[model samples]
Structure formats: structure tokens, C-alpha cells
Target: MLANMGNEIYRKIEQVKLLPLYTATDLTYLDRLEDILVKNNVRFIEVTFRSDLAIEAIKKLSQSNELIVGAGTVRTQKEAKDAIENGAKFVVSPAVVPEVIEYCIEQDVPVFPGTATPGDIQRAMEYGIKVVKFFPADIYGGLKAINALSGPFYDVKFLPTGGINEENFMEYVQNDHIVAVGGSFIISESLIKKDDGETADKALKSLIDKINLQK
Candidate 1:
């Protein structure tokens, strides 16, 4: 519950609005993602532990001083601990978990717990967190939904994911409350499957350029 935390995340978002999230195992593929992030000066990376090699991947990426690495799909307090222990500076989960929330707070690690409805948000607010993830963002009405929340939850900040993309990226990043977005565009399945390091580099840089241009 980082309710008191300001739009520092939005500043973080501005720095890394266009990011690549490697959500699965495949240490082999991350080499491409890392190369793109480095070559293009992309600012963030989410190395999700949805696979067997996540801890190893986090260790691998930790060597890079430029990347702000986070752990996505974090569910339990144990996973959160593992993420932080291994090198994740932040953690994000697709759903609200009270214990995990408390763990992050005590550990001083930023956690973006997901919420979709007003009730869900209220539940999150009870914990005193200001920043929350708008999970399945497109399914939850996307920007329109976020706009609706602004009236009642003006102080809240969001890191919209799930359906956020390059074509619709600006619509989210440009919003006053949106901190950033997490997606596969900068490192999509097709790109990874092909091991297209060059394409990934171009895409990551192009996305950064696009977002910065809008700013």
C-alpha cells in the first residue's frame, strides 16, 4: 500500500513508458531482449517467473546497470521474496494478495497489485496503496475506465497492462495518472521465436522515440 507515494512512478513511467516484459522461461531468448533494451537505451524490463529459469534470468539481467528490472506475475509472499532476493527491484501481480502486499511494504519494495473494478480498488485503498495495476486493461474498458476512476480516485496511479500496445500506447502513457505500461510488444512472441535481435532493437528504440516524441 504505497498510497502516500506520489507520481514518482509516473516519472518512472516517463522514463520507461515503453518496456519489454519477458514473461516466461527461456534464458536463451532474453539475450535478444537484453540486447534491444541496451542498444536502444530502453529503460525497464519485467522478468516474470512464469517459467523454470526466472531466478537465473534475473541474475543474468542484474549485471546490466541500466535496466530497471521487475518481477511480474508474482503471487505469493515467497515469490516476492525470491524476486527481491534474486535482483528484482519491484514486483507486480495480476491479482490482490494481502500477505504479498504487506511483505513488499515491509521489505521496501514497490508492488503493483492488480485491480479492475471500483470495489477492487476500494479493497486496495484499504491497504493505503496509491499505485495499482489496471489488469486486463482493455477488458476493463481501458482508458475510459481509468478516466472514470479519476473522479473518485484522483490520487491513484496506474501501470496499465494486458492489451496495452504500440498502436494504443500513447492513449495510456499520455494520461496524467498512468505511470507506465507492461507489454510484450518490445519483445513479442514472434520476435523471440525468430530470435530477431535486430528487429527487437529497432522496435524498442522506435517505441521509446515514439513515447518521447509525444512528451
Candidate 2:
């Protein structure tokens, strides 16, 4: 089982407690953005499949050994396969899709499927999934939901995404149950359009500084 091979996803998150969720419809700024992420010491990043350029970008970024690239918003088996075949180190979904989870497991790829309710968590457990994404976290009650799930699902870990920003991110990370937090507010798409990366670089550095200070 891939589970026995060791959970690389958790290992990466433990090393650096932040996962920047990025989506770029424009491929022009990908290289510069990757540089900014690396400069801030971000070892793991999710290049979401929100655009056509996402696959190509993942392929380009994964060529670098310095960064562990993952595909986010993967909703289908084909998308999962494409991402993994193109060198995505992991896969993430906004909701649970049993087939997608099964395919990833079969391929020995780590996947963080989204779980919003007790039923979702239970189903994921059935699939032998160790980690999941508590998506749209803020709107679904944030830390409270995570705490509630801890009682019965203590072994399961979470990567909370959606509505996470600088202010509340530290709060989420403080919880040991939360493996990582995914946010795109600081690495705004508009900033990427600037091309020079000065704005994105500054924002990333500040966020990384805060994470280091808390540690």
C-alpha cells in the first residue's frame, strides 16, 4: 500500500507549515512566481487546475527539485491521472470523490480529498485516507469544525483551504490537527500580472517571516 511507503505529504507540511494555493490563467508569470515562492522558503505549493495553463505549469515547476508541486481542484479521475503523469507530487480536491481517491491510491500518489461533514470523513476513512482538506473552512465554522471532528476522527489530519488569510492562518496552524493551511490572498493574481515579481516577493517574504516568528 502507498500508505506504508510513508506519507510524503505530511512530511513536507511538517517541514514548512504553509501551502500557497496558486492559480494562473496566464503562463507568462509562472517562472517569476515560482522564484518568489522559492525565495520565501516555501517548499510546497499547489498550482490549482483552474486554468488551461495549469498542467503545463505543473510540468515546468516540478522539473525543479527545490519545490514539491501539487495539483489542486482536481475533480475527476482523468485530471488526477494527468496531473500525476505530468509530475505533480500530490493531488487535492475541493470535495470527496471516491474514484479520484481510489485512482490516486492505486497509483501510489498522495491525495488530500475535501471533507466537510462527518459522512465525508467517514467515507474517506473507508478509503484509508489519512489526510483531507477542510474546504471553505471559514464559512463552515473554521477551527470549530476541526475540533468537532477530532473527537471521532482523531487520526485524520487536515489541510484547511478557502477564506484563509494572514490574520486567521496562524490560528489554524496553531492546531496540531491541521497539517497545513492553503491561501492565495497574499499571492494575488493581480500581483502576478505585474511580471517583475517585486510585489509578490514582498508579500511572500512577510508571510514567511510571520510563520517563522510563530515557530
Candidate 3:
């Protein structure tokens, strides 16, 4: 039953196509970020657990049902619990941790743990994970790596993140095996630091325009 619930959440992400992986030290940027996402027709955002304010950010953003907010960079079981309590609809980890995955399973929340090698992917599969995050995708050979895994892991889907930008994003998302492409390209830390909505809007609109044209 929990596994079925996870798949339901995964389908929602697959429909969106783009998953903006954001990390901000300041909580002030989340609202503005949501505005930019909504304007560009994006429905989901992952607030990374890299900062001390990640939980607060997720809580604040989850108040609105219009946005699908999640917690990223989750490492420990405790973090997973905390994220869910704060209203994270899903949880993502940089690497697969059996304990953390188990915690998410018990809570019945979806999880996308990072997997690099075949061994990592295999281990995640044993944990009933059907989808995973391909971290550092550019250096990990991008589509080449995903293609390689597709042969053996035919039932699995991937969300490639890291080093992904508008210039080469379609290459990853266009593939059937990839559920979505995640990166900070559309909302980079530097852009958030500037706090200039006009500049950010232009960049986001350009990306969205390209995406629509591709479709």
C-alpha cells in the first residue's frame, strides 16, 4: 500500500517534467521562488536540507496546496521524520540510506534517493524504490549512464540532477526512462541572492518558452 502511494506521487512529478532543486540559506526567497515557478507553469520545488532553515522553508511553502513542495538532501531517519512533520509531501536523499528509506516507507511518503553505480540502484530496488535521483549527472556520463542502466533496470525511472542547465536539460528529460530533470539552473543561488524578481522572471520565462516550444 505504501509503495502504491509512492507511485502516485511519482506520477505527479513525471507530469511536471521539471523539478527545481533549490538551496537557500534565507527563508525570504521561498515565496518569491514560488511566484516565479507558478508564473512559469511549474508546480513543484525541492527545498534542500543543506541549510538550518530548510524545515522552516518547507513548512512555510507547504501552506499553499497549489505548490508541490518537498525536502531534498535528507540524510538521516530523523531528518525524514522531521520533514514529513513539517508538511513535506516527499523526501529526497543525496544517497540511499536503508534506515531513512524505511522511515519514509513507514510514513508512506515518497522518496527519491541518489544512486550512482549499478550497485546503488540495485540496493535501492531491494528497498522497493522504483524511482531514484541520478546525482552529478553530467560527470556521471548523463544520458549515457541512464541508457546503460535502462538495459538492466527496465522497470526503474530516474530524475537526473546536478550540473543540469537550460542549455542541455531537454537531453535528459526527453528520454522515457527519465521521470524529470532537477537543477538550480532556473533558480540558482546567485539569482536568489540578487532578489531581483524582474531578472529572475526573464530567465524563467526564457526557459519555459523553450520548453513549450519543444513540446
| lDDT-superior candidate, 1 or 3 | 3
The CA lDDT of each predicted structure is 0.77, 0.85, 0.86
Write down the TM-score for model 3: 0.94
Q: Sort the predicted structures by lDDT, highest score first.
A: 3, 2, 1
Model 1 residue 210 CA deviation (Å) reads 1.4
Candidate 2: worst-modelled 10 consecutive residues by lDDT: 1-10
Ranking by TM-score: 2, 3, 1
**1-215, model 2: which lDDT tens digit per residue?**
75764376678786677888888787777778778878887878888989888899888888877788999999999999999999998889989998889898988888889989999889888888878899889888899999999889999888898889978788988898988888787585678777588888887788778878888
Regions of candidate 1 where Cα sits further than 4 Å from its true position: 1-10, 193-195
Clashing pairs in 3: none
Q: How close is candidate 2 to the true structure, as a TM-score?
A: 0.94
Instruction: List model 3 lDDT by residue over 1-215, tens digit each.
Output: 55799877788778778888788787777778888888887888898888888889889989987688899999999889988999899989999888889999888889899998899999999988889999979889899999999999999999999888889988877899999989888675568567556787788788777767777
- Model 1 lowest lDDT segment of ten: 1-10
- Which candidate number has the best lDDT? 3
TM accuracy, model 1: 0.90
